[model samples]
Target: MSGNRLYLSVSLLLSVGYFWLGWSLMQPEPKHNFTPCLFKNVTGIACPSCGTTRSVLLITKGHLQEAALTNPLGLLAAIIMLTLPAWLLYDFFRREKTFYNNYSIAERFINKNKKIIIPITVSLMLGNWIWNICKGL
Candidate 1:
């Protein structure tokens, strides 16, 4: 197979595996211990991505609110997890950056407002981190 095809196949497999692993981890008697978040382990503070795994697990189990409370970014991950396969399939057929082309206007807006965007992103991350810490995740 060509390199691009091989890469897409590998990516699709890994994405599916990730979702399956999340589902398996949510089982009633998971046989493995959950790994603590590395950033939290060293810093003793919740990172922006803290609780993301639990959030994904909760989302897989149909607990949307709990998933959001666990970590909003987890919701984003779930969306990506669900959509990536389709996107990859489309990309494999098209072999073009259609997503970027279609969203060029939005991309230009982001580039223009990069300074403003940075602060907003930082505040949102900080807020999420604070919420995670409050929940003692």
Candidate 2:
């Protein structure tokens, strides 16, 4: 297969894996062994993306409150998990990369709003970090 098709196939596989993970975690007792987050293990603190897997599984199983409690990013991730495969499949069949073509717009927006964007980004990140710390995750 061509490079684009190869990438799409890999993407599909990853999506399926994540979905399977979510399904497995939904069980009364998860049978899989989980590796602790490396950052959390070394630092004694939850990393920005820590709890993401649990959160995704929770959200997929319709446990939104639990998902948010696990990780705020989980909500965003769930949305992406739901959408990205369809997006990739659409692009694959079209034989064009629509997702990659939108970068210039984002770049222009960032360049125009750096002063406003930087502080907001920092605040959100710091706030989320504090929340994670408070949760003792």
Best candidate, lDDT-wise? 1
- Evaluate residue 31 in candidate 2 and report its C-alpha lDDT on the 0 to 100 scale: 65
User: Which portions of model 2 miss their true places by more than 4 Å?
Assistant: 1-35
What tens-digit string does per-residue lDDT give for candidate 2 at 1-137?
A: 44556566658777786866657576676465443678777777877777777788877679999999988988887787777777777777888776545445677799899999999988887888888888977
Error of 1 at 88 (Å): 1.7
Query: What is the C-alpha lDDT profile of model 1 across 1-137, one tens digit per residue?
Result: 44465556658776775966566585686466454668877877788897777788889789999899889998988887777666666766888655445456677888999999989999999999889889887
